[model samples]
Target: MRKRIIIFDDDKDTRTICSLILEGLNFEVITQENCIDILRILDLHTPHVILIDNHLPGMKGAAGIRLVKESPRHKHIPVVFFTGTNNAQALADEAGADFVLPKPVDLARLEEVIELAINS
Candidate 1:
């Protein structure tokens, strides 16, 4: 079965690029520009993994990660922080992410990370 992947990013290009890359790898991608009511996305289904922008417009980098990590219903899904910053991986670690990938994410690396997360 294809893994469900939920992506949260404010940039159209980033979101679209990620959707395309993941789709090519056979992941079912569910993307959103707004994180206001992520509960709605949860209703659609629990993604096997989540890809969140390190710097969202309204929310702080780690704040959004905390909310998802703390949520009882959605907590189990592994999250990877994606950012253009040089410190992206550090931020992800601080935010308690399972992994972190530099933005303009390499599709090959992402596929490996996702597979590892799923297998683990």
Candidate 2:
């Protein structure tokens, strides 16, 4: 089965590239430029995996995760904290993410991570 994924990031280029990479890997990808209204997304659809940016304009990444965790319908969704630096690991921990990966991630690694995330 094809997995559905969601990417929430403020960077346009990052979103575009990641979307392409995931799509190439045979995954269905949805991207959000602004994650301030993630609750609305929960109302629409539930993705198998959610990839969020560490740095955004309005709220912290952890805050986004907390919101997801609070919702029973969406709380079980796996999340990956996408960052541009090694610091992402610490931030991802703070955000309650399942994993942390730097932006412009290695496609092979991403593919492996996706498979693991979906199965786990």
Candidate 3:
């Protein structure tokens, strides 16, 4: 089966670009604008990796990552905190994210992070 990646970011362009890139790399990519129903989404997709941006419309990405980490059923899945925010590494650490991806996202780095998350 193809590896699945779930992305939560409010920016439409980022989501589209990421989807295209990952899809090209043969991943099944799912993107959401917010993490309001993150658990529901997780239950449905069971992704290999989750990429999230800190700023979101509701249920911010950091909080969403925390929620997933706190869940016994889903905590094993790797989470990559993708953000443009300052102190992103600190925020990702606080939220228990497995990795961090900073924006103006370098597509190559994005792919590298995803690969690391999947392989780790």
Candidate 1 weakest lDDT stretch, 10 residues:
34-43
Q: Which RMSD does model 1 reach against the true structure?
A: 1.8
Candidate 1's TM-score: 0.86
lDDT of each: 0.80, 0.81, 0.95
**Stretches of model 2 off by over 4 angstroms after superposition:** none
Tens digits of per-residue lDDT for model 1, 1-120: 889998888889888888998899889999887566665676677889888886677676566777777888877888888778888778788877888878788888888887887776
Provide the global lDDT of candidate 1 against the true structure: 0.80
Off by over 4 Å in 3: none
On residues 13-90, what C-alpha lDDT tens digit does candidate 3 reach at each position?
Answer: 999999999999999999999999999999999999999999999778999999999999899999999998999999
RMSD of each: 1.8, 1.6, 0.5
Tens digits of per-residue lDDT, candidate 2, 21-119, equal 899989899988767888788577679998888677787666887788778888788888777867877777766788777777787777777787788
How many angstroms is residue 58 displaced in model 2 relative to the true structure, after the best TM-score fit?
1.8
Question: Predictions ranked by lDDT, top down?
Answer: 3, 2, 1
Candidates 1 and 3 compared: the better one by lDDT is 3
Candidates 2 and 3 compared by lDDT, better number: 3
